[model samples]
Target: MLTDPTMWRPAGEMHRCLTDGGSAFTEIFGTPFFDHFARDAETAAVFHDGMAAMSEPENEPIAEAYDFPPTGTVVDVGGGHGGLLVEVLRRRPGLHGSSATRRTS
Candidate 1:
């Protein structure tokens, strides 16, 4: 099950440390590490590329498991980088879709 950060202190602390430290983390995991990814643009690019390396294979099973409503408009809210929505639209050719930062008044 997923845990909400507001309700869980350890999760929040872990996230903080991941974003904050090098020694406490690098000691356990060793070098060629994420400190650069957190700060450097080139490293971030390489990190994102590494993450994308597995995305297509990782997402194929998920794409097969679900169906999108095909005839009406579908809005994806805060959909991360639009990848999943793009995949859904690709799989469901008849659907009209839009992705928004948020639903607002």
Candidate 2:
């Protein structure tokens, strides 16, 4: 299993193999997973849809509990695609919206 990276290894065996090696499955898969999903349009869309559905309603309670000033520009830093910001704007229409992400070279 360790020698062959792509072979169909069972989950239990894979878990044991990685755990015994002191390397997490995430350690092996994280970079490639993010690289592929982040760059691929279809993958990114699927991921966003999943995340959006998860964010809604589950976040509403927390959103309702918080208080924001009636008017001001709220800059959401490193806000990925602005899902949370959209929710906040939807709840509080008076607040101005601004999102900033680190520019990728």
Collision pairs in model 2: none
Q: Tens digits of per-residue lDDT for model 2 on 1-105?
A: 222332232333566665676424345545443454555557555655665676665556765677977788778775656777777787899998899944432
Overall lDDT per candidate, in order of appearance: 0.54, 0.60
The global Cα lDDT (0 to 1) of model 2 is 0.60
Q: How many backbone clashes does candidate 1 have?
A: 0
In candidate 1 the C-alpha lDDT for residue 93 amounts to 85
Pick out the ten consecutive residues of candidate 1 with the lowest summed lDDT: 1-10
| Candidate 1 TM-score, C-alpha based | 0.44
Model 1 ranges off by over 4 Å? 1-39, 72-83, 96-105
Q: Residue 78 of candidate 1: its Cα lDDT?
A: 51
| Candidate 1 deviation (Cα RMSD) | 10.5
Runs off by more than 4 Å, candidate 2:
1-34, 77-81, 101-105
